[model samples]
Target: MSGRTRLRGRFQLFATLLVTLVQLPTVLWLCWLTRTPLPLAVAVPVSFPYLRQLQSPWHTTAPALSTYLALGWWAACAVFDVLMLPAALAVQAGLPRGVTWGVAGAIALVLGTDSVLGRPRLRKRVVHVEGLSPELDGYRIGQLSDVHCGPHAPESRVSSWVARLNALDLDLVTVTGDLITHGSSHVEAVARALGGLRAKDGAFACMGNHDYFTDGEHLVRELERQGVTVLRNRGVVVQRGGARLYVAGVDDTWTSRHDVARALAKRPEGVPTVLLAHDPDLFPEAQARSVELTLSGHTHGGQLGVPGVRRLSLARFVSRWTAGLYRQGRSWLYVNRGAGTTGPPARLGAPAELAVITLRRA
Candidate 1:
């Protein structure tokens, strides 16, 4: 082999060894701190890397490990905190009252402010277009979903998302679903934030599983009030400079309300049709109905991914197109990782995304 090739191989090996070494201490420390046994100890290191592979591996071994780690960590923390509370209280009672109070106040202020200021981060992704038809070449579509706007994510985060969406200079925008959590208050706030989104072709949306759990009708109305067209198994033809395109939106799958046939019935004949479904599972049905492209964002790309393993092992069972661009025969699907988070406020492996898709005549 040439010297260049040899050097490259050596560098790769060195990098791999370096990563393993760096991770080893953290793994050991986590295991020690948690006071977990050997078999359970392996979970901390293993779960972190497994969450990063959401886009590739279809079947992964991380979810089980992740569950183990989550349970283990929660149990450990709960026990430790419970045990420490009395001791801390006892010490506080014995100490000079004012000194203890002052120290406690200072610590609370620092930690509380840090918690409020260091809010959960949202990942930004800009998918570049390469092979697109010149006629619709520069047509950009911004997609956001699973915002779950609630106590965890306040109005400021929603506003930030709106600003980012507006900055994309998109021709059209779509919200795939899960806009808010358990109430209509956050939904209304999100709607107001999304009202700032501007697109030439206009912004459209569909409901997700959470929307049904909350007040779906109210959320839909609020979105409509904010200039968003909520398409529940319906479609509309958008014309730009004489080039016509069909945009279809479907209901959420978890609700068992998705009707692709109804959505496709309104499409104009022989025009390029795109379907916006909340889940990627609609791809097969969309493809069967001759949809050229399908945009979806339900799975948060396994929000926490393991590095070498697949992210969100549960996703493969749910949808074939978990994240990113995919093809089903002649039809194409682009699954966004979503603009916001879900259950946990923390994002370890998979980050949020804003998918910008450009369609072309193939």
Candidate 2:
């Protein structure tokens, strides 16, 4: 009868409907792929979210860890549906059953390689920016984003990332956000690992939606304690000799409101500013303020795409600025594919990235 109870009912109904809808494709593929339908395996992933939402007291509000983890498993199985679509098309085109089976096997192999190997490796890249501050020209800013630490990505990987970044000998560093996936029990350990990262002008970060999922402030405090600047809707001037580089950050545009103007208020009109934002959709606003560069990561490049092709992804269904570089007017936005996984432990086409953005004066 209460509004809260009504909302909970609606959410449960919606989740149940979703699970039912997805079941057809998931079940069809399991029978087609494995040649044996395992009822227990199918039910565990497909029904977990729906059941968890219905059973838990916080049905409409906060979700339990098991719920989040179940979502991950469900997401992984979604790929099987995608593969099945193509297989169905092939069958419709009069392909032999034997040929379709071969295709399914190939798909499984690709998925295995990507989830086990490609997604875990730390990929390095260089981005060249035009009109970068000459004082900062050739200056390397290491970027680590979407560190969905906890279950999918652990503290050990975070420590390894820190060692890798320190080895780069970067002049400046920024973590675009999502340092913690859903909670912050090991936030201090992750922060301590990040503390080992050495940069001439120090390391900075912004917040992401996932960070706020659970005790986000705890992670922020730990980061600060470890000497990393948690820039939340604030700006600071970085000096190397007499040259000045403006650095600022705004809270996540999707999770929380992004106050771009508030962040750049104290910044001069054009002082070669670098804004740390979690979502690339904020680029237009940053461009309005003449921000030279913006760094972000949230999409994880959809976590599944054509490996050789790279740019194509389901993530594009939601965001055109899902990953990679884009220029509008004088401002440039670089959306790192992110360093960790969320939802599912698998990443298909998009590999984890460690960006070294070099300021190149043209």
Best candidate according to TM-score: 2
- Please, what is the TM-score per model? 0.65, 0.72
> How many backbone clashes can be found in candidate 2?
1
Task: Quote the lDDT for 227 in model 2.
Answer: 90
lDDT of 2 by residue, 1-362 (tens): 99877876776677767755655676666666578768446666645654644623222222445554444444445556667778778888999977885777566555644553453354444545555666777777889998877755678878888778888888888999888766557687778877777899999999988778778778888889899998899989998876788899999777666799998989965578899999888888898878888998988888778765645886787578978777887678888888887754556677788888877776
lDDT for 94 (candidate 1)? 97
lDDT of 1 at 160: 84
